[model samples]
Target chain A: MTLLSFFNYWVVIILMMVGFYCVIARGNMVKKIMGLNLFQTSVFILFVSAGKIVGGSTPILRDGVEVYSNPLPHVIVLTAIVVGVAITAVGLALAVRIQEAYGTIEDDHLRDDFDEEDD
Target chain B: MSPNELFDLLILALLIVCALAIARTKDLAAAVILFSVYSFALCLLWVHRGAPDVAMTEAAVGAGVTAVLFFYTLTRTGRREK
Candidate 1:
């Protein structure tokens, strides 16, 4: 396929990489969570866009509407978005707790704290 | 290309830009706001792609609830990346 045909997928790939980089490169706990959110969003976009069919309308039953874009992916993405929200909530809660306990949320700082305790 | 394809391209461009900006920014609050913009762009793309239901959910959960959650956490934590 030509570049235009696969452009959407290419963008998704870039976004995934960007998110992954943020997760690995950042020491801040909240930043990592944001990165994870970006990664999940890219996946959601991938599935939803893949479900589109050229010249087709929404997956609703309407008179004189011939083709409908695949509904399954939309349904799947909907569930994924909810799951993502749950994940974000839990992750943020954990981050807050980490801050409260350690007084800092940077990964390296937390590591140093653990090292001092082990001594 | 048709208008639909052009719209898709524009939205995808916004997604890439937002993702990169979020990654690059050192300010936690700015990153969160950029992410909200990102979510809105994705929501718009979903609507244009014939998935209005998914669009609404993304708008509400992604842009609304998620940003609020992030800001709440930021208030507890600090806004600086370092």
Candidate 2:
């Protein structure tokens, strides 16, 4: 309805597109993982922003404070952050292994190397 | 616009720059550094929006742990994109 609200979602979408472009256009495995990280972070921002109330304070309770922001997204995002870290760790480990196996982590090189091995 | 919106606009601008920087860089290390900056902006955005828990998590995981992990991987692999 309003420009501000629309901008919020638009920013997330734009960020996601950037990450997606990195994932698809880039050839380096590490860069792909970074792109994936960027993508996930954008989604987290979108969810948290959606849970925020215009006139609300943090979820902490107080004697006279009302209209606290939603805590569900916060909890969900906390869990997601841990999962994201785990994923990143595993991805980096895989990148390291890919380099050791192929002598290079570039996607094209890896594909070529794997094909050579198959032949 | 209000102060909060103004801050959000600034962070949004920095985020765009960081994303573009990460995308265009051919140096893997430089890209990781840009990603660190991007994550810091994300953390600040969360703090500005009153989500301290998420902010902390973003700082620790996105900026801290993830960066370290990538650098470790970079050590094992070469740093150039090609």
Candidate 3:
């Protein structure tokens, strides 16, 4: 593979790992959502990267440029962005409710609070 | 290998390290910050992949909106050990 292509792939892989790590390691509910957002963002990167052509131009109607980057990926990413925003809104709402009910957002703390209630 | 490839490898290694740190961190705030970094890295990835629009959206939604939401939630809740 060319140097650029290799580089692009590496970036996507790295971001994916970081994002996954955030979701799994954080005790705060909000942090987990942040991690989830990162993970999804990485996926978006992957899709866009996949659509790239080394010599392609923008997918606009033009006279001379014969090669153009895939427009499908652009459309997909736009939709994904909207979806990501909606999910973030929902996640925030849930976090708000969780805070109201338990008075804490930390996973460990929330678990303990629940345990106390159970007892 | 080319210099670009080496740089890519270095960045990938850094990303892995950051991800592991995020997973291992005990502090919720730290985790959130790490997650934001991850999103930024992903945005870079999108740019590298030649999709500036996707990268832009990722930066705006993933790094900006999501981080704000998480921070707001974190602040609203108490941090005292239960």
The best candidate by DockQ is: 1
lDDT of 2 by residue, A3-108 (tens): 7778888889989999999999999989999899889888988989889888788888779888878989999989988998899899889888877877898888
DockQ, per-model, please?
0.90, 0.82, 0.44
lDDT of 2: 0.88
Candidate 1 C-alpha lDDT tens digits along A1-119: 25655998899899999999989999999999999998998898788778888878999998999998999999999988899999999999999999999999999999999999999
| Model 3 ranges off by over 4 Å | A2-18, B1-18, B30-34, B78-82
Model 2 Cα lDDT, one tens digit per residue, B1-82: 8887888889988998999899999999999899999989998988877798888888888899889889989888979888
Ranked by DockQ, the better of candidates 2 and 3 is 2
| Model 1, residue B40: C-alpha shift (Å) | 0.4
Model 2 regions lying over 4 Å from their true place: none
Using TM-score as the measure, which candidate wins?
1
Error of 1 at B67 (Å): 0.4
CAPRI grade of model 1: high
Question: Which 10 consecutive positions of candidate 2 chain B have the poorest summed lDDT?
Answer: B1-10
DockQ of 1: 0.90
Better of 1 and 2 by lDDT: 1
The digit string of per-residue lDDT tens for model 3 on A30-115 reads 66776676577667756776787765766767699898788798889889889988988898899889889877777888788879
